[model samples]
Target: MDFHHVSVLLQESVEALNIKPDGIYADGTLGGGGHSYRICERLGNNGKLIGIDQDSNAIAAAAQRLKEYESKVIFVNDNFANIKSILDKVEMNAIDGAIMDLGVSSHQLDEGQRGFSYQHDAPLDMRMDRRNTLTAKSIVNEYSEEEIRKIIFEYGEEKWAKRIANFIVQHRQTAPIETTGELVEIIKRAVPAGARRDGPHPAKRTFQAIRIAVNDELGILETAIRDFVDVLKVGGRLAIITFHSLEDRIVKQTYNSLSSGCECPPQFPICICNKKPIVKLVNRKPRLPSEQELEENPRARSSKLRVLEKL
Candidate 1:
C-alpha cells in the first residue's frame, strides 16, 4: 500500500507556526510531508526542515513527496518522542517552530495487512513502527483480562471494556486469538446487540485501545512537549494537532504547565520556587478545522490545533 495520509488541520497548523523565511522548523509527525511541504514553500534557501517518523514507510513517502526541497529537508526514521536526540544529531540547539499531528494516518487504516482497522480481517498487528516487537496479537492473546479491560476503559473510553475483556479471555483460552477478525467477533459478542446498534462499529473502541497500548501512544507525550519548548527559540511556536480527546488533553495540560508561572501558594507573600512562564498559549482554545476542510476530508473532523509560543 502507498504511504498516503491526508494531513489534518493543514492550513491552521502551518499558519500557527508563523513561519520565518530563514528559520529552522521540525515536523515531528511528518505524515506524507503535508505540513512540511507547506512549511518548505514558505521558507527561503536558508530555511531548514527536519521531518521525523517512526514508520519507515512514512519516512520514504515523505522523503519522496518533499524531494523538491531536499536541499532544505532532513528526514529521520524515528519516533517523535526522541525529538531531542533527533535535533541534537543535526546540531540544532533551537528551532523557530515545530508541529506534531497526533493522528493515525489514513494509509495505516486503509491497508488491511497493517491490522490497524477492525474492518480489516488481517493478523492482529498494529505496530506503528514495524521494527517494534510488541504487537496487538500479543496484547490480545497474552495480556490478562483485567489488564485488557483497563486499557480499553482508560485508553479507549469504552464502557463495555469489562465484557469485551471477558469475551476475549474466554475465546483465547480455547485457541489463541490470532487475527483482527477474531478479535472483532469477540467484541461483537461481548457488546449487547441493542447497544451495538446505536453508535460506531462494535469493535472500533477495542481496536483503538489495543493499537494505542501496543504503541504506547500516550507515553513520552508530556516529555515531548517539554523538549519542544526547550528547543523553541523565544517567540518560536509549537503547534500541535490532536485527533482524539486523550491526545488533546495531554497537549493542553502540558502547554498549561509550561505556560503557567509561579508554583507558590496563593497565601504566600514571598516568591519561593522562582519559576517563570516559559511559553504563552497562542490561543485560549484549540483551533478546529473549517467546515470546508472537514467536508473535503472527513478524517479531519476530530482534529484540534493548539499552539504555544516560547517566552
Candidate 2:
C-alpha cells in the first residue's frame, strides 16, 4: 500500500504553532508530509523543518511530497520519542515549534499484510518500525494470559478482556495463533454475541490492545512529551493530536505537569521546591476537528488537538 495518511487537524495544528517566517520547526509525526507541506508553504527561504517518523516508508513518502522544499526540509527516519537525541545529532538546541499527531496511518490499516487491522486476515505483525523484532505475533503467542488480560483491559479499555484472554490461551494451546484472522476469531468467540451486537467489531479492542503492546505505544509517551517540551524554544508551541482517550489523557496530564507551578501545600507559608511552570496551555481544552474535517475524514473523529507554548 502507498504511504498515505490524511493529516488530522492540519490547519488548527499549524496555526497553533504560530509559525515564524524564518523559524525552525519539527513535524514529529510527519506522515506523508501532510502537515509538513503546509508548514513548509508558510516558511521563508531561511526557515527549516525537521520531519521525523519511525517508519521508513513514511519518511520516504514525506520526502517525495515535500520535495519542492527540499532545501528547507530534513527527514529523519526515527521515532519522535528520540526527539532530544535527534536534535542533538542535528546540532539544533531548540525548535520554534513542533507537532505530534498520534494516530495509526490509513495505509497501515488498509494494507492487510501489515496486520494492523482485525478486518484483514494476515500474519500478526504490527511493528510500526519494521526494524523492531517484537511483533503482534509474539505478544499473542507468548504473553501470559494474565499479562494479555491486563493489556487488553488497561490499554484497550475492553470490559471483556478476561474472556478474550481466556479464549486466546485456549485456542493457542491447540495451535499458535499465527494470524490476525485467528485472533479475531478467538475474540469473537470470547465476546458474547449479545455484547458484540451493540458496539464496534467484536475484535477491534483486542486487536488495538495487541497492537499497542507490540509497539509499546503508551510506554515511551510521557517521557517523549517531556523531551519534546525540553527542545522547544521560549514562546515556541507544541501541538499534539491524540486519536484515543488513552493518548489524550497522557498528553493532558503531561502538559499539566509541565505547565504547573509550585507543588507546595496550601498551608505552606513560603515556596520550597521551586517548581516553576515551563509551558502554558495554548488552549485550556483540546481543539476538535471541524464538522467539515470530520466529514472528509471519519478517522479523525476522535482526534483532539492540544497545544502548549513554552514559557
Candidate 3:
C-alpha cells in the first residue's frame, strides 16, 4: 500500500512553528513527510530539517516524498523519545523548532496486514517500530486480567473495561485470541447491546488501549516532551498535535509545568525557590481543526494542537 496520511493541522502546525528561512527544524513524527514538506518550503538553502519516525516504512515513504529537498532534509528512523541522542548523532546542538503529530497515519489503519485497525482482521501486532519484540498479541494473551483492565480504564478511559477484561480472559482460556476480528467479536459480546448500539464501535476503545500498551505510548510522552524542550534553542518553538485526551492531558500538564516560574507559596515574602520557567505557552488553549479541514478529514476532529516557545 502507498504510504498516505492526511496530515492533520498542516497549516496550523507549520505556522505555529514560525519557521525561519535559515533555521533548523525537526518533524518528530514525520509520517509521509507532510508537515516536513511544508516546513521545507519556508526554509532557505542554508536551513535544514531532521525528519524522524520509528517506523522504517514511514521513513522510506517520506524519503521518496521529500526527495526533491534531499539536500535540505535528513531522515532518521528512530523514535522521537530519543530526541537528545538523535540530535547528538546528527551533530545538531539545538533546533529552532519542532513539531510532533501524534495521530496514527491513515495508511497504518487502512492496511489490514499491519493490524492497527479493528476493521482489519489481521494478527494482533501494533508495534509502530517493527523492531520492538512486544506485540498486541503478547499483551492480549499474556497480560493479567487486572493489568488489561487497568490499561483499558486508564488509557482508553472505557467505562466497560472491567467487563471487557473479563470477557477477554474467558475467551483466551479456551484458545488464545490471535486476531483483531476475534478480539472485536469478544468486545462486542462484553459490552451490553444497548451500550454498543450507540457511540463508537464496540472494539475501538479496547483496540486503542491495547495499541497504547503495546507501544508504551503514554509512558514515553512526558519524558519526550521534556527532551524536546531541552534540545530547543532559547526561543525555539515546539508544536504537538494530539489525537486523544490522554495525550493532550500529558502535553498540557507538561507544558504547564515547564512554563511555570515559581513553586514557592504565595505567603512567602521573599523568593526562596530559585526555580524558573523554561518555556512559555504560545496558545493558552489548544488549536482545534478548522471547520473546512474537519469536513475534508473527520479523523482530525479529535486532534488538538498545542505550541510553546522556549524561554
Candidate 4:
C-alpha cells in the first residue's frame, strides 16, 4: 500500500523549530516526511536533515517524498530513542533543532495489515518496527491476566481494564487469539453495553494498550527526551507533538525538570540542590490544532505540541 499520513500541526511545528537557513535539524518521527519536507524547504544547501523512523514503510515513503531534497536529507531505519548514536554516525556533533510527533501516522492505522486500528480486522500485529519479535498476538496469547490488566490500566488508562483483561484470558484458553477481529469481539464483550454505546469505540483502549506494550512506546520516551535535549546545541529547540495524555505528561514533566532552576526543598533557604536550568519553554503551554486544521483532519484533534529550547 502507498504510505500516506497527513502531518498534524504542520506549520506550527515547523515554525516552532525556528528553522535556520543553514542549521542542522532532525525529524525524530519522520512519518511520511511531512515535517521533514517542511524542514528541508527552510534549509539552505549547507543545512542538513536526519529523518528517522522505526517503520520501514515510513522510511521508504519519506525517502520518496523527500527525493527532491535527497542531497540534504539522511534517512535512518531505527527508533529515535538512539538519537545520539544516530547523529554520531553521521559525524554531527549537535543539532540546531529536532521534532518528534508521537502520534501513530494515519497510514499505520488505515492500513489494515499493520493492525494498529481497532476499526479494521487483520492479524494481531502492531509492531511499529516489523523487525521486532514481540507482537500484539504474543502479548494477547501469552501474557498473564494480571500483567495484561496492568498494561491496559497503566498504559491505556482504560477504566474497564480489569474486565477486558479477564475476558482476554478466558478467550485465549479456548484458542489462541490470532486476529484483530477476534480481539475486537472480545473487547466488545468485556466492556458493558452502556459504556460501549457511548464515547469512542469499545476496542480503542485495549488496542492502544496492546500496541503500546508491543512497541514499548511509553517506556522509551522519558529517556529519549532527555537524550535528545543533551545533543541539542544552545538555542536548539525540540518540538514534540503527543496524541495522548501519557506522552504529554512525560514530555511536560521532563521538560519542566530540565527547565527548572532549582530543586531545593521549600524550607532550604541555604540554596542547596543547586540544579541549574538547561532549557526554557518555547511556549508556556502545549499547542493545539486550530479549528480549521481539526475540521480538515480529525486525527489531528488530540495532538499536543510542546517545544523546548536549550539555554
What is residue 77's positional error in candidate 1, in angstroms?
0.3
Q: Pairing residues by index, what is the TM-score of model 2?
A: 0.98
Better of 1 and 3 by lDDT: 3
Model 3 C-alpha lDDT per residue in residues 24-119, reported as the tens digit of each score: 999999988999999999999999999999999999999999998999999999999999999999999899999999957888898788888999
lDDT of 1 at 121: 97
Q: TM-scores across all candidates? A: 0.98, 0.98, 0.99, 0.99
Please give the CA lDDT of all the candidate structures.
0.91, 0.91, 0.94, 0.93
Misplaced by over 4 Å in model 1 are none
**Model 4 segments more than 4 A misplaced:** none
> Per-residue alpha-carbon lDDT of model 2 for 198-246, expressed as tens digits?
9789888888887888888889899999988888899999999998899
Please give the range of 10 consecutive residues that has the lowest summed lDDT in model 2. Answer: 1-10
User: RMSD in angstroms, all models?
Assistant: 1.0, 1.0, 0.8, 0.8
Per-residue accuracy of model 4 over 46-162 as CA lDDT, tens digit each: 999999999999999999999999999999999999999998888998999999999588999999999899988899999899999999999989999999999999989999999
Q: Which pairs, if any, clash in model 2?
A: none
Any idea what lDDT model 4 has? Answer: 0.93
